[model samples]
Target chain A: MVKSKSWTMVKHFEGLPKLEDFKLEEKELPPLKDGELLLESVFLSVDPYMRPYSKRMMKPGDVMIGSQVARVVESKNPAFEVGTYHVTNVGWTTHFISDGAGFQSLPKEWPENLPRSLAVGAAGMPGYTAYFGLLEICNPKEGEVVLVNCAAGAVGSLVGQIAKIKGCKVVGSAGSDDKVTYLKEIGFDEAFNYKTVNSLEEALKNASPEGYDCYFENVGGNYADVALQQMKQFGRISVCGAISLYNDSVPATGPYIQTYMLFKQLRMEGFLVTRWMQRYPEAQKHLLKWIAEGKLKYHEHVTNGFENMPAGFIGMLTGENIGKAVIKV
Target chain B: MVKSKSWTMVKHFEGLPKLEDFKLEEKELPPLKDGELLLESVFLSVDPYMRPYSKRMMKPGDVMIGSQVARVVESKNPAFEVGTYHVTNVGWTTHFISDGAGFQSLPKEWPENLPRSLAVGAAGMPGYTAYFGLLEICNPKEGEVVLVNCAAGAVGSLVGQIAKIKGCKVVGSAGSDDKVTYLKEIGFDEAFNYKTVNSLEEALKNASPEGYDCYFENVGGNYADVALQQMKQFGRISVCGAISLYNDSVPATGPYIQTYMLFKQLRMEGFLVTRWMQRYPEAQKHLLKWIAEGKLKYHEHVTNGFENMPAGFIGMLTGENIGKAVIKV
Candidate 1:
């Protein structure tokens, strides 16, 4: 019998998620099935979408859902060999059994010096989400303006950079000066600390005076509405997430923009990276190439130990992470 | 001097527009310049979009903005021969002076059998809007389900028909029983009076067990939010207009849909027909062909005399018109 640790949702969150809402427990694996491979949790990813989707897609007693990069220590499936790294949707567990079907086998050609934790950060869901979401949905053209919110976070940071790669003028909104500086360092043409900004519309207009042609909306609420107004005709909005109103104590309102979209002729699309899972390897190929070329930069705010998953998730919710928030065991 | 009567906005309205809010003015037109043409209104089209844009885009004292099919009475511009028909952005005025740039000669292939008033309704902006907005943004795949609100209106009617032509199941929501029946008679898969439906969600669910794959949103507010929840994963929403909340005395408050869009991976795009004017000829090509092939149909709720423009506008807003509302002069 193998002992593994897992975090389970103990209670629903009303506002900010507390450490008490999650409880960690130890379990013993009975045995691996014929097609299942035993993965030893190495790094866990804490993302904002998990906060809302857990309340939606999971029962209270169910294990908290998330993704992690793990090493295949023992395998019943021939496709996954021992000592190979893989990205799997095994949740907040220290050990998990996954079939080769949905699990991705990370390339062994990856530079040995590069952190393997990036498999969940820049090179994993966050990276591909930014890549495909911007390239596919935003469909950015050269000289076009691309605006990203939460630009310091996991997905938004990469979104801005990728839009730049596609020959777009990238503008970003972050919560802090450090993140804004980091965004500027990463080739974002314009970056603002939305926390200090008095008016969202003024800040957005200042950053993008000509108006944004493509808006990557990871932050919803007032920021989105202001951005909606500043969009040029036929502009595209890629709605990856809405972190602002996820844990509201009461239903939220404002940015009253349902009508503006029609007059401005804007397009806002929400996407899940899984929608492009079929072409995930294709995305990884380009991402890996970008990393190899030093054209892509990834930052990780890792919380050490399995018991700290809640803290990591809470940290991410509060915008404590620079690029991607990860839990390392 | 030429005597021509016109309707001018006396003041902005508080709720539904009333006749008292407009002032009737008989103006003497000055002589046309050497390069200008004199136009006399023949047919006028009333649409819902004018209601909202007027408050923001128009000042306290400006000629009412609308498209009109007019006949040139006298011309110095060679393009406009006297007695020639043209579509001009000539507002609500009975007469106006324009150079060649203000008008386009009515297409020779234009159906003489069809009412010339349709050039402003079914075969004009509303018709072209439904064609492009639905096909391009919604992109309904075969066997997918499509839903449209205000289905008896000019834009909504055409949206439902286009979805049907694309081999998708079509459902529509109307404000009254007669319009509901008319939607079914025109071959809607399901048509319901939203006013009579006890629960919009239940009605939509019962109507779309498989879930709506494409939504042509003309009505905003709770109706859109409820329809949004019923959308299938990867659904597409074309934000054509929001007629439901157009006349609201106050702003609308409802559940925020940005979160739902992310989970469902839905795509919502807003569009105006003018953005595609570079391809305007193509719209005429497709809409005219569809009409000739009997794959498409048109309805006009004609009210005689131009004096009723305000009443016509209000009637259109209140959903009194079964289809396109036209004021025949």
Candidate 2:
């Protein structure tokens, strides 16, 4: 028998999540039955989605939901072998037993030097998110201006780089000067620290006076209100996240969008990455190829231990991470 | 020379327009040159759009912009014959000289018994607005549920009927009990008076417990906020007008929509009827055929005489009209 450690939510989050809101629990795992594999979580993901999703999908005392890259420690299943790595959504646990039903084994050709944590970061869910959200919804055309907020975060970072690959002029904003510098290094044509800017509207205008043709929206609320007005005629908006508004106990109020949408003939769509579940492999292939070619870059903010998972998640929500936030178990 | 009488805006409207904000002016028109035709306004349209458009497209002393069914009183242009009627966007003037370049002549097969005013109502811009806005943006599939507000007005009435023709279940809401009755008479599966409903949320829930698959939004602000919440997963919204917000001196504030939109994976697009300008004839043909087959119906709120044009426009903005509001000059 092996001991398993997991985190559970003490209560639904009211605003930003805090350390006290989580409780660490330990339990003894039973012997694995035939066809079952014992897996140890190597790296756990902490994302902005967990904040809003907690209110919608979790209850008090329930294990906090998430995904991880894990290694097969022992396997009785014929399809699996010991020491193979796979990505699994078994929540925030150090060890879990699975029948190998939904485990997604990492590609055999995964670059040897690359950290396996990326299976839950870029080249994984975030990569697929930026891939489909920007390409499918915004559909950026060559030479068009594309704007993305939270530009140094996992999804937004990839969104800007992908629009660049498609021949678009990419403009992005992040919360800190360092993140803005990182964005500039990653080939973003324009990058601004939204927190330091005197006015978001002027910052956006200075970046692209011709106005945006495609807006990959990650920060909603006042940022969205101003950004929406700058869309050129027939601009497309792909709403991937509303991190700024997610913490509000009540929904925020802002200027009605219908007038701008009408005059500009804008099309706005909201989507979840899971909507294209069947096409994940296709996105993963492209993401891998780009990384191998040095055309795509990824950064990770890895918290050293499973014990710091709550702090890492809280820090991520507060925008402390420049890229994917993950915990090493 | 013909003396033309027209109404001009005294100044930009601050809120709901007042009678003192308009001034009647008279001007003499020049003799027709070769290729020019003298036309007399027969019937003019007064629509909700005029309220907002006046601010964007007009200034003090400028004649209010509008479209009219006009008779060719005299013609130096060989393509147009005296006594033939055509639709022209020559604003509020009773008489004007045009080069016949952009005039659209009434269909040769137009039913003789129908009033020529229908050229500016059911067979004109409002009809095309409904035809394309709902069909193109919402794209209601057969057996899906559709919800439309302002259900007894020109575009809304047609939108509901067209959804039914497409084999979808339709629910509609109007401001008055009489308008609600009119919606029921037009074959709406469910109809309600929004003004009298205890709660818009309950009203929408009771009308269609399954939630709406398509929403045709004409009235925005609070109505849109409530209606957006009632949309089912993957629902589409066609934003045609925002009559509720048009009169506000400042844009109204409302609950942000991105959260609901994300969870439902909704698509919302705003459009003007002119977006489908080249396809107007296609829409008009279908509208005429449906009316001739008695599958479509039209009602006009005719405000008599040219002098009442401003009053007709104001009344329509105030929701006094049951259907297309027109001034018979």
Candidate 3:
């Protein structure tokens, strides 16, 4: 028998999540059945998506939903070998018994020196999100300008870098000066501290005088309203996340944007990374190769210990982390 | 010399346009030069686009821009013979000399029994706007549910009807009970008066228990905010117009909709009909055929005389017209 510890939501989040709202629970698992495997979480990811998704998908006392990099400790399946690392979405659990279903091993060409936590970060969901959201949706062309918000976050960081790799001028906005520096270090052409800016409109205008061809939207609200006004004709907006509005109990109201959209002939689309699940391998292959070539740089904000999962989640939602927020167990 | 009488904006409209904002000016035209033709306006169109466009495109002294079906009274251009009718965008003018640069003649197969005013109504810009906005942007698949607001107006009525023709279940919302009746008369699967509905959400849900797949958005504001919530996953919104928001001196405030759009994976695009100008003939061909086959029905709210041009325009913007609003000059 194996003892597994997990975090469960005591109640649905009212606004921002609180540490008291999470309860630690433990259970002793029965012996693995045929073809089942025992796995222990190595690195657990706490993304911005969990905040709003929790309200919609989870009830009180439900285990916090998330993805983690896990190691197979014991296996009864013929195809499985103990000690192999894999990425799985088994929520915020320390140890889990699985039937070896929905477990994705790291890419075959993954560099041995690189951390496997990347399976839930750089070369994982966030990477795939930046890949398709920018390339497929925004479709930035060479010499064109691309704008991204949440510049230091997992997806937004990759989005800006990828836009650079595609020969497009990239402008990014983040909450802090440190994040602004990190953005510049990762090859963003222009970076701004949105919190310190006198005017967001002026900041955006000063960054790109001509106007943006593509906007990778992560923080929606007043930011989106202002950014939309600065889009060139036929600009495409790929909305991957709206971290700014995730904690609002009631939606924040802003200026109606239909007029801007109509006159500019803009296209705005919202998508989850899973929309292109079948193409994950293709995205992972590119992400791994780019990282190996030093073309794609990654950063992880790891919170030590599984006991700090709720704090890690809350911190990420509050924009405390500069990159992918993960718990090292 | 032919005398041309045109309506000019006396001043920029502060809110909704009034008669005092217009000034009728008359000028005598010189004889037509080589390749030029003299035409008299037969039927001038008064559309919702003029309201918003007037603010963006016209100055205080500029003529009110619009399209009209004109009779070629005299011709120096051999290509355009006298006594023939052509569609030209010459603003709100009764008589003008054209260089035949932007004149479009009626389709060759136009039925003799059908009124030529249809050139600017059912078979004209409104028709093309509906065809491409719905077909190209919404791209409704067979048996899918389509939701169209402003379902009795020029472009929207055609959108709902076209969705029906494509074998989709069409739900429509209009301002008045009579407009709702007109929607049902035109083969809409479900029609409701948005003004009379107790709750717009319930009305939409009752109209179609399953959510909408293709949303032809003409009326923006609260309607869009509510409709967006009820969209099925992967819903495509074709934003042809925003008549509801056009009259606002300052933009109206509304709930930020990025969350609903994100989880639903909805795509919302705003367009001007002119974007598909290259494919106008393709749309006109289908529209003309549909009208001839009695598959498409059309209604005109004819405002008599050139003198009522401003009133006709204001009335159309206020949603007084059930279908295409045109002035007989």
lDDT of 2 by residue, B1-329 (tens): 79999999999998999888989999999988899999999999988888889999988999999999999999999999999999999899899999887888898777987888888888899999999999999999999999999999999999999999999999999999999999999899999999999999999999999999999999989999999999999999998998888989878999888888888999999998898999999998999889888888999999999999888888988899998999999
* lDDT (10s digit) by residue, model 1, range A55-122: 88888868899988899989998888899998888789999777877777678887787888888888
Q: Give the DockQ (C-alpha) for candidate 3.
A: 0.88
Best by DockQ: 3
Per-residue CA lDDT of model 3 for B76-127, tens digit only, reads 9899989889999989999999888867788666798788998898899999
User: Mind giving the per-residue lDDT tens digits that candidate 2 earns over A83-110?
Assistant: 9999999899999999988877899778
What local lDDT score does residue B224 receive in model 2, on the 0 to 100 scale? 93
Look at candidate 2 and tell me the lDDT of residue B298.
90
Tens digits of lDDT, candidate 1, B1-329: 89888788888877888888887788888998898989889988889988987887777667788988998899987767898888888788888888868465678767778777777877788888898889988999999999999999999999999899889999999999999999998889999999999899999999988899999999888888789999999999998898877777777777667888888999888777777887767887788788878888889998888888989989999999998998888
Q: Where does the lowest 10-residue lDDT sum fall in candidate 3 chain A? A: A101-110
What TM-score between 0 and 1 does chain B of candidate 3 receive? 0.98
Model 2, stretches more than 4 Å misplaced? none
Compute each candidate's TM-score over C-alphas.
0.94, 0.99, 0.98
Docking class of 2: high
DockQ of each: 0.69, 0.87, 0.88
CAPRI accuracy category, model 3: high
Residue-level error in angstroms, candidate 3, position B259: 0.5
Residue A311 shift from truth in candidate 3, angstroms:
1.8
